[model samples]
Target: MPAVRTTFRSQNHRGRSCRDFPALTVTFNVLQLMTIAFVWLLALVPLTLMALGATMLRAVRPAAAPPGAG
Candidate 1:
């Protein structure tokens, strides 16, 4: 019957669509991971600069010895 043939075609299309799902999912996950990594790197910049500045200050001004340690 024509209906049976149409159902078969529909099932074949659905099978192809299902097969394509993993690739699409992987692409989406990769994009999401990249976005998250970009955000984390962006957030880290200020902290990284602050830490670098603190290190520079330490090198510029050595800590004085404590009176009790003398």
Candidate 2:
């Protein structure tokens, strides 16, 4: 009788632990996704500004050849 009770207790504990695993995994996945999105946005800002600056410079300044031109 004691052995049967112990087995039932262990089974209940195992079932609860298993149920909690997916919730922990989903939380971790959400945090990782948020971190990746933040890093991507941080990187994109500088690149976008650089592209805009290049476009503006091209519009404002025309290229000049050397003094001894053909």
Candidate 3:
């Protein structure tokens, strides 16, 4: 029989955990939210532009080909 050894140990901070680190935690959360929003908006803008361009091209381009092919 072999004894099992744990590779990870949890820190037993009695009361001064991440909750105690208010400014850094709040800043990190705010930055995370902003980054997510920025990435989402970045994706949305291009898709919206592509959709608008496709619609405009479909509306304005002629359907018939030039009169030369048989």
Candidate 4:
């Protein structure tokens, strides 16, 4: 209840509203989302590449024959 009452007032105090500045809000939202996505990409890409490299090496290496086999 209190939060709802202050929401519009806060926007008015800052002179920014979605209706008043649609493009600005959309751009800000996009940039925020992109920042989060970029962080995840940075963290996952290296781990993914390392795992892929390990899998490739595992596939490339052949298993040795059993000791008792001729």
Per-residue lDDT tens digits for candidate 1, residues 1-70, read: 4554445456547556545689888888999999999999999999999999999888766456555664
TM-score of each: 0.56, 0.53, 0.59, 0.62
In terms of lDDT, the poorest run of 10 residues in model 1 is 3-12
Tens digits of per-residue lDDT for model 4 on 1-70?
A: 4654445466546764578888888999999999999999999999999999999888765545456663
- In every candidate, how many clashes are there? 0, 0, 0, 0
Best by TM-score: 4
TM-score of 3: 0.59
lDDT tens per residue, model 2, 12-64: 47547545689888898999999999999999999999999999898756555
Candidate with more favorable, higher lDDT: 1 or 4: 4
Clashes of 3: 0
Higher lDDT: candidate 2 or 3? 3
Q: Which stretches of candidate 2 lie over 4 Å from their true place?
A: 1-18, 62-70
Worst 10-residue lDDT window for candidate 2 reads: 3-12
lDDT, candidate 1, at 25: 83
